[model samples]
Target: MHRFVVIGGGAGGLELATRLGDAFGARRRNPQATVTLIDRNPTHIWKPLLHEVAAGSMDPYTHQLEYAAQAYWHGFEFQQGELTGIDRAAHTVTIAAVDDDTGREMLPSRSIRYDTLIIAIGSTTHFFNVPGADAHAFALDTVAEAERFRRRLIAACTRAESNDDALRAQGALPTHKRHRVQIAIVGGGATGVELSAELRNTAQVLSAYGLHGLDPRDDIGIVLIESGPRLLPALPERVSTETARLLEARAIDVRLGERVTEVAEHAVRTASGRDIPVDLTVWAAGIKAPRVLSTLDGLTVNGLGQLNVRPTLQTELDDDIFALGDCAACVWPTTGRNVPPRAQAAHQQAEFLFRAMRDRLSGRPLRAFEYRDLGSLVSLGHVTAVGNLMGGLIGGTMFIDGLFARIMYMSLYRMHIAALHGIPRMLLDTLAHWLRRRTVPRVKLH
Candidate 1:
């Protein structure tokens, strides 16, 4: 009986685990193989949606998948623990004990032996050691962090309004020019751009709740700061230009080529020694693999802490151990560029590895992982979206905006769901969410 364990219940790992379970978990009588998934969190949510969650535009609970429930439905065992280390020689993974809320030791620190191991622990925000960034700026990495940011946004708006009221009661000019909550979003990547737009939209939604006469275009100021010369530097030139145009039209101040030297409690100091005052700051700049990856006993990692994997997605030192997603450095065959750490690339890699694992189990040669060049998409809230279609599907460099790009961006998440739960279940969940959305408030006011 083969024992397979997948670490990290992220987009790539979760989907692959579900597929493997469906294939192996149902057969009870014929010496069925055991499949287990381990994650720190009890639930899983698409990482890209963290921006929306941070802006309070989407209810995360509705989108989150309970690991225990999904594991039960898909016929796999779900272990609630964090991986501390792996022993390749012993074919075992050491999991740290999870301390319960009541100070009880629910699960002891233990080792689980596996015939195959997949590491997909994902990445975290790279602050670049900017002064005060760790203490002042909010990062959108986890559901908890997003929710915290959302609450802070709402509170800032409320506090600004109250401050204005206090000045009014003191017999000052009614519109005596008080700055509203000014948000500074550092990093011009998709997460930073998308979050800025979503925050603006959420401000509009929040205005109805006692923010009388507050003009989104005037009172609420959003500044997107990028160290590079243009936004979305990784995307095509046209995509960045078009995106900048759309954002500027919405009254968002796009500051390009400005390096942030420091982050203060209420301001971001730029390399040019300009201190831009802000009420709320969000740092979406850069990313690096989880710190744990660098310390893996027999793994070689780059400066970014990403494990160096072969073309087959297996660790260079161990064939039984594989890695994917943001934590794995998989080289591109043609361009010689390591594959970009994007969700689409991770999904594609997961599917390839899934098939390769089954082949290896059946005494067949594993196929090399090939990366497909899928152009990027950036969603600027409900205002607009921009992207370039790849695979020559829409010809060379098709710059799409408005509805088309929005639909394309959404389909990416839908595709991930389809991979995990099948098309029928994904469609049902989509329809259910749509209907529920109509009856709920746009923002999570609570």
Candidate 2:
């Protein structure tokens, strides 16, 4: 039996393991292969939804997939540990064990050998060595980080509401006579943009609970800073324009062409010599692969820590190894640029690798992976969404907005859930969430 080990149970890795287990694990008495999946977290949350989680608009428990339970149902084995190092010569992976939240010693630091290894460990926030950023700013990279931001946000609001007199005496009050919480998001990409909008909506809901004189539109201030010349610069110009208009309409101060040179306790300094006073600072600007990527033996990574992969998605230095997702640098032939790091691209890469792995086992020629640009979509809270879609089957780009775009944006998430839990479970989960949301407060109160 082939010992197939997949590291990082993320969007791409988890989906691949599930499909492989379902196909190979449910055989007669004997199984064709053994599939093992390892992850730092016991539960999986889709990365794209991290912003919503951070903004307190979504609950992590409701969306998380328990890796152990998922493995039991899908015919795979789940091991929880943090990857520390790798030995290519020994074909082994080193993992460090620790106590779980329940104070149980799960596993010790150990090594696992694999016939085939796949690395899908996603990227992490790169603070660019900005002073005080790592210590002060909130990052929406994981559930813990998101939850931390939400807690601080609620506390900040409560402080403002209860201490209005002191704040007013300090002349912080605007002409509108509303209590305010100033939040600065230091990135204008989809994550920062979506999070600003989500926070605006959720903060409004939070104010209804005796949050005296707090008005989201008038009081809660959201400032988005982008170093680039425009928002969503990677997308179409029209998309950027539409996004800017939507954000502006929501009273979000979108500061274009502004770079943060320094971060302090209560403010951020721009390159153009301006101090933006803010109570909460969020760093969503830049990202690179985990620093561990650079130390992996026999693997070639770009300066960004992305593993350099061939057209077949195999590591340039090691054919027995494969990589995908935000960590892999797979170039696009048409644009001569590396494939954009997106969930859609990751999903496609995993699908391609599924076939390629089968061919490798069968001693046949493996097919190369190609990225298909399916346009982009950005949701501006619950109010609106905008983007374009393009697939070879659909001919040219198709414009979408409003409710139509919202549904499409949601479908992307549903597709991820469906891949893991199947249609019946995914539909049931969706229904349960919708019903629960209608009954509970929109923002997390605790």
Candidate 3:
């Protein structure tokens, strides 16, 4: 039987492995292939929702999908380890030993031979080499980072409230003096914009829960600093304008055309010498593929460290090795540029690869992958969203906003779930979450 090894249990990788296993794993009487998925984390969460996780709007525990459970249900194998190296000539990949929280070894290092290898480890936040940025600012690239920010947010609010109360009791609380928590978000992309909106709601929920004494609207300040002229530069300008208007209407401080030069312990300094005092800083400026991609046995990579791939999604240097998602630099013939690194693009690549792999097994000719632009959506809190829908069916781009747009934004996640577990399970999962929402706080408190 052919052995297929996939590194990374991200959205695209996990979905592809599940499909391959279902079609060719041991469960089938005449199994043709064995699928194995490796990931550093035991569970998987959608990358786009990391902002919600950071803002405490989403409880990650309730939504995380355990890889072991997924593998058991889908006829695939799960390996918990980080990719250390890949040997192209030997047709094997080395996995580093994994250690528990207490520094005890959980799994020893091992090598897995594969007839075909797929790399989809995803991307990480790029800080643009700003001084003190990497050391002080937080990046929402993983669950742990998001959770850390959430905890710090709760602590900051609590500390500010306590300080205000102490000042009041000591008769030192002046009428004009108000304790505040200021958050500085660097970037105006989807992650930054979405996070800013979510943070606003989080502040209100925190106040409603009696977790803080400061006024949510006035005492909690969210400053969004963008080097570009507008927010969501990748989206239509109309969407950007509307998104800016929505955020500004919520009292968020949207600073445009100002590049951050440095990040200090308590503030962010801009090129204009403006210092924005902050209790916390989040870096969502940009993204680059993992550094490991460059060291992968002489695989050709672009300046951003993304593995260069042909239109077929096969690496330029090797046919047995493939890459997808944020890690691959696959060209878009329509735009003459690499496909934008988005969840939609990743989903499309996974679907294409599934069909391509099947064709290869049957000795049939493989088709080139073509990416379709379905437009984009930017979520503004829980009640509103701004974006445009594009397609031949729409005859052009149609702008949408308000509650309808928010629903459409949410449906993207639902569609991802359906891809992995089918429509019935996705529907059941949605119903279960809806019921659970009524019994719990809208935002996570702890």
Q: Pick the candidate with the highest lDDT.
A: 3
lDDT of 2 by residue, 1-446 (tens): 77778899999999998887877664326777788899988899999999988888888998898999989998888888888888999989998886877988877888999888889988999899888898889988899999998988888887877677676789875464422688999998889989988988877788776654567677789999999989987788888898899889888899999999899999999989999888999999988998888888868899899999999888998888999999999999999999988999889988888887778778898888988998899988875788898878368998778988999999899999898889999899889999998898777777
Q: Give the 10-residue window scoring lowest on summed lDDT in candidate 1.
A: 24-33
Top-TM-score structure, candidate number: 3
Report each candidate's C-alpha RMSD, comma-separated, in the order given: 1.7, 2.2, 1.1
Looking at model 3, residue 99 earns an lDDT score of 98
Error of 3 at 24 (Å): 1.0
Runs off by more than 4 Å, candidate 3: 175-179
Task: Write candidate 3's Cα lDDT for 176-208 as tens digits.
Answer: 443289999999999999999999999999999
After superposition, which runs of candidate 1 have C-alpha atoms over 4 Å from their true positions?
Answer: 26-32, 102-104, 173-178, 211-213, 392-396
lDDT against the true structure, per candidate, is 0.88, 0.87, 0.93
Better of 1 and 2 by TM-score: 1
Q: Name every residue pair that clashes in candidate 1.
A: none
lDDT of 1: 0.88
